[model samples]
Target: MISFSVDFWYAGIGAALIALSLLAFLLSKRLLKKLLAFNIMGSGVFLMMVGMAQTQNDGAADAVPQALVLTGIVVAVSATALALVVIRRFALASVVAALAAENKAAENDAAENDAAEKNGAERTGSDTAVSDTTVTDTALTDPNLNKNGDPQ
Candidate 1:
């Protein structure tokens, strides 16, 4: 008959957690999900370390592994915070870049319209009003423009 100790259970569970978390992390596309999976994997590592420590010390609590786990928890929390900040910045940058591209396209379109109107007026000797209304209408009707007529 085989005997399963508490230490063995802990190690087994920890290994399973590590494997599942690793898979989740790799398969996740979102930054937040990946971060959560990474944190779970860290927890699994701590559990495995504690289980190994107890096994090595004849089921007695060891100070080294406990201290290491404590330190790791602190570092993990700090790293998570840093990662969140980075993710927020990255999202903001992407939004800004997209808005800039839309604005550039809108500006280019307005310039082309103005140039075309000027050429048509010169050819026919007729004056066309290149007013703000024309530009505003173009901007307002644009799918890329926001409600305020700003390019999104």
Candidate 2:
């Protein structure tokens, strides 16, 4: 006959939680899902510590593991808050960068149209009018270009 105590069950559940959360963390792509998985992994670690400590002390609770878990919980909460702030800032930065790029493209198109109009007006009396086609040289316009006009 095989018997398992409550402590043993707790440890098993903790192990399972750790495994599942680890899998979720690895498989998830989004920052929020990864953060949730990290929190679940921390919970599993705390559960395992408490369960193992109790089992070792003959079903009696020990102060050391409990204290450690308490400290860990506080630290985890602080870390999670910090991570949320970082994720939000990163998301906002990405949006700002995309909007800036869109605005720059619009400005470029407007400048090109203005230049073409000016050229068309200047060439109105000439027999050969300037072509409407505009060619942009990315190498010349790239911000990363070095002082020597080479890509940095």
Candidate 3:
């Protein structure tokens, strides 16, 4: 007749797990910080529910809570997967957009350099208070060109 009374232990474990889970959810952690913490919280909740079931005089574990935990874990996995997919998509799109902008600038610069080769006078003089490049505000790189087709 030396059976242990697991009621107090089970209750204490359940309370601790619930408190920790809430703390994990309420803390001001960055959204992308890590996913391990969320998984740990889910585990804690599972344990807490299981421990609650154990608090009863029955020494055997129940099946309902275990099944619930399985379902919840599946749902969590789906949500995490979707979130990761979205983050990856956004990161890729940002990189592509930046590359396209750079490519456009390069094309513009090449066209200006070609015009300078064909029309030397428009790019190489400072005889006035404002050369063509300065008059049109070229300042090393220009978005507009003079009638002779050189960047200004």
Q: Each prediction's Cα lDDT score?
A: 0.67, 0.66, 0.54
What number of backbone clashes does candidate 2 have, counting pairs of residues 3 or more apart or in separate chains?
A: 0
Writing each residue's lDDT as its tens digit, candidate 1 over 49-87 gives 999888877778889999999999999999999999987
Per-residue error at 47 for model 1, in Å? 0.4
Q: Which digits, one per residue and each the tens of the lDDT, describe model 3 over residues 24-117?
A: 5556354443454565566667766776776563746778877897899899889788868865664564344333334434556766755544
Compute each candidate's TM-score over C-alphas: 0.68, 0.70, 0.49
TM-score, cand. 3 vs. native: 0.49
Question: Which candidate would rank higher by TM-score, 2 or 3?
Answer: 2
How much RMSD separates candidate 3 from the native structure?
A: 16.4
| Regions more than 4 Å wrong, model 2 | 110-152
Whole-model lDDT, model 3: 0.54
Which prediction has the highest TM-score against the true structure? 2
Model 3, position 55, has a per-residue lDDT of 58
